[model samples]
Target: MSRIPPIKITPIKLIIPAMFALTLFPVFYKIEAQDLKLPQCQDEEIVNTVVDFFISESVWSAYGESKIKEMINSSIHTANLTLKNSCVPMRRQSGKLYQVDMTIQAFDPDLASYRNQLLRVTEPTIIKEITQKPNHYYALVVDDLPDDILGKTDVYLDPQFLILSDQAEKYTLEHELGHLANAWHDDTSWNSSLSKYLEEYTPDAHKNELHAYARGYNCAGRRTIMSQSSVYYLQLPIYSSPDIFFGDETCGDHEHADNARQLREYARRLKDKMKNNV
Candidate 1:
């Protein structure tokens, strides 16, 4: 992602052996080309199989199960965070489930509302399998991935998260769930608007990116969940450590977290509106 100047600090050089240990041989962080897809699975039995894939992929390891539940909860169960003017009522397509497609789709207002309820009103729903498609935004688990690469979304899958196993769990799901959050990415002209931040930093340098993200958006460096404060405190790019943060030199401080307060405010507004609607 770093296309601008070289990093000022000594770059974190990884020895070849260390890189291999982290599975960096096939770096998934390569600049992505076009979106890609998996074999489509829309049939009921096929979808069930996909669900099984998710359970198998997620349950064995503590990290897998915990991450999956957290993702599902935050994605649909949490309160809304969009502006009031944009809020809408949740509708239920009872017994209807959108099959996983390889393609990405903008959030349906009704679906967004219903998903909120699914997260808040109803118990968390778990799919043993998933139906996949191209040109769609979806998530499912598979045996094909390595443990470090346990989680995958198209935004997180075909490209970035598949190889960057260390951060894959959150980034993969956050990238996909960001879509559900009314967050924007990909071809909505974010490249020109946001790419500069990624461009200005060093490869894997994370500080300034966190400061620049507005609501309803997600990306590599500083994003709402995956890119930001993870359960493990990936330090990522914005904050120096779990407890310490750079004061005002947000854009420069690799550990700065300028917008967190504003972000919380926005999230509260959205949550209240959604609750009222429900």
Candidate 2:
């Protein structure tokens, strides 16, 4: 009590700080909601493509398959898209399934490390022999993977195979297939030109739109299934006009056309290489 001088409480300081926080809270909350919003299906073709993918799968469990079908039906109803019966052949026939031994030192820590080491140590000749056909796809579904990795594809391997974690999304299979098709990431140096074009030429009609078409790479104007940075579908529509296409001319003024071209070229080159070896 001897030193109980005036406890000078700065009322103005307390009031100012409280007012500032109240003023900013609503703005911060609104921004966070917008950022956290999940992407919604917008294009009819994209919705149908997703449906077709689920229908084409032959390896999913009965329950898993039913869930995918249910999702497709719900998306269709929500988007008001006409459903069709068409289905393309599954690009990969079921091959020998390998359960990655997560406990092994060869696969310890993370699947990415294991994948890299596996590719490095394993011979292409051995893989080709084991696979029988050099162009047959293989499947490797692991029970778990490092928390950050959903799925991965080794395009360097002939008839590329995908390694997926159990928790991966239904669409992850299609995403890895994009890698198998030799489609580079939308932001990778391989697609830099297209990325630039997307940034500069986003149309007024599409301005402020949040369609799947506008969430790829840093471009934020074109979406592709190959994009590691966007919410996209497996639909690949070719366009004849810039009015419809979202990327640069290297993409043939069409969505997914460049990826298609790359796959064809890769197939041709691989075929030639194999023939020469024989």
- Top lDDT prediction, candidate number: 2
lDDT of 1 by residue, 12-65 (tens): 221110000121111223222122111221222110001111122223243543
Worst 10 residues of 1 by lDDT: 15-24
lDDT of 2: 0.34
lDDT by residue (1-278, candidate 2, tens digit) is 13212221111111000000000000001111122212232323121111112111222443353454454333233222111111211222222322122223443544345444334434445345544544544434444466556666654433355565545553455555545544444443434544444366434442232122221232223233334443433232221112223333222223423343343344454455456655
Query: How well does candidate 1 match the true structure, expressed as C-alpha RMSD?
Result: 19.8
lDDT of 1: 0.26
TM-score of each: 0.28, 0.42
